[model samples]
Target: MFPTLHIAEKTTGSRGSLALLRWALVVIFLWFGCMKFTSYEAMGIAPLMQNSPIMSWIPAVFGVQGASYFIGTAELVTAAALIIGTFNKMASAFGATMSCLVYAVTLTFFLSTPGVAEPTAGGFPAISAGTGQFLLKDLVLLAASACLLLASIRPADA
Candidate 1:
């Protein structure tokens, strides 16, 4: 055991970490959401979205440009709600819920999209190092979003 660590001190540190995590999430959502509005970003994700059963129809209904704008709007709104959470826990809780739902869909891309794994190295389940890595990073964001969800729901308890 570390003699230097104390319960109160640890709690303070944990709280600080959570605050930073929440703020980081807010920034990422806003930034990425803004990127979705650009043609480069839209096209970059189009292939993955097209292959996804859960997302394929998006293009049909909204078209690529429209879909990208919609995604950007959603992200902007989510970020706004999270910002509001700084004062209103209810708003933050709603934002966290939205974030959880979005992250869940992105996680599903591992199964829905092709070329996500390395074919030459091991093929199929092996997963391409780059794509696999990109998808893998979502787990941390998912966890952070979930933590925010719990915090929003429990408020005082969290």
Candidate 2:
């Protein structure tokens, strides 16, 4: 149970937390985007992505680099919009759509790949069970994004 605090509606704490979350999301997006650009070769995900039937159209246009750039730009723009707080609703909506797309692509890849196990580090077994696990996690993230988008659009009167 949480402690009850009869605080004023105008308290800075709630607003500050919201700001923190916004910035945190921005940092996460920037980090992932940078990773996609910088570590393309080592990641080995590009081939899987290219082979994915769901992403077949992606390789035709930008190839791996172009796809990476496009995804990176989306993340960067979403982060910027959220941080600026000028277009929070639109940004969140876009982010939710992006998350859903990612989830779908990853899920399709997992389903197509057989015996695709996560790589082990040192002597320890990998944490993820493979693409299926990745899909499951991404789905949860998609749900979270959807919730954020919904909350952004919710009517105050309701």
Candidate 3:
């Protein structure tokens, strides 16, 4: 019924989409991870870390600057493993798992951080530009990470 559409779909398949997603994740991790080394980024994230019950220990133990560095290192490592995973299935699974965990923690910022909801907008569904909007993207990243994880763990023969 849709010969041209089917032909186009077959020509440019799921592999392209998967590669795009993987590369996009790598870029995000690398860019954000590199930024974490800077003082401004460290200072910016201080409020979120300080407010988080689960992440509060990071700033308390490592200090603001040190915490950023630690997180940055983890992000860089995840990006590296993902890149290497192109060839190695084990690396891919590990990277996907790490990405999942990272996004899960960041997603909590919506609940833990103050001023996430715009008071003038009546709060709740209205997310503030400062922290709320920024963290919202993590929802997509978390989904991508989960998809990668499932793809990585599936039997090779299948």
Candidate 4:
């Protein structure tokens, strides 16, 4: 479990940790987005994209490979915005919104992607250890993105 945050303390550790989280998200987005430029990444996501009603138009508009590039570009740009947000409030707001959008969109794949859930001895909502785990992990990213968004959108103290 993570340590409890004391907002009133305004400790160096707290601010540093928050900053580090932002940097980590930026790096992860950049790395994953870069992978989309490759054939393997494109192919790997083909089924998920095809199955997703929201994303079905991607292949028609950008083609399978091109869609990957488009997503990759989005990722890189979002990462850049987050990096800029480190210094500017407007930039942080933009980056935070973008990051949150990305997380929300991807999280929807829980509905579109098959094998995400499997029949288990327990019940109807059992999650697959593989694909299910992968999609569920995005919750943390969503929370982190939300944190950034809240920090950026709130009015500065007088």
Best by TM-score: 3
What's the number of clashes in each of the models?
Answer: 4, 0, 0, 0
Cα-lDDT of candidate 1? 0.82
TM-score of each: 0.87, 0.63, 0.90, 0.87
* TM-score order of candidates, top first: 3, 4, 1, 2
Better of 1 and 3 by lDDT: 3
Candidate 1 segments exceeding 4 Å error: 1-13, 155-158
Task: Rate residue 121 of model 4 by lDDT.
Answer: 40
Q: What C-alpha lDDT do the candidate models reach, one value each?
A: 0.82, 0.58, 0.89, 0.86
1-158 per-residue lDDT for model 3 (tens digits)? 76564444332226567677788999999999999999999999999899999899998999999999999999999999999988888998999999999999999988999988998899989989878899998999998888788778887665
Better of 3 and 4 by lDDT: 3
Window of ten residues with lowest summed lDDT in model 4? 9-18
| Candidate 2 TM-score, true structure as reference | 0.63
Model 3 bad stretches (over 4 Å): 1-13
Give all candidate RMSDs, comma-separated: 3.2, 6.5, 3.6, 4.3
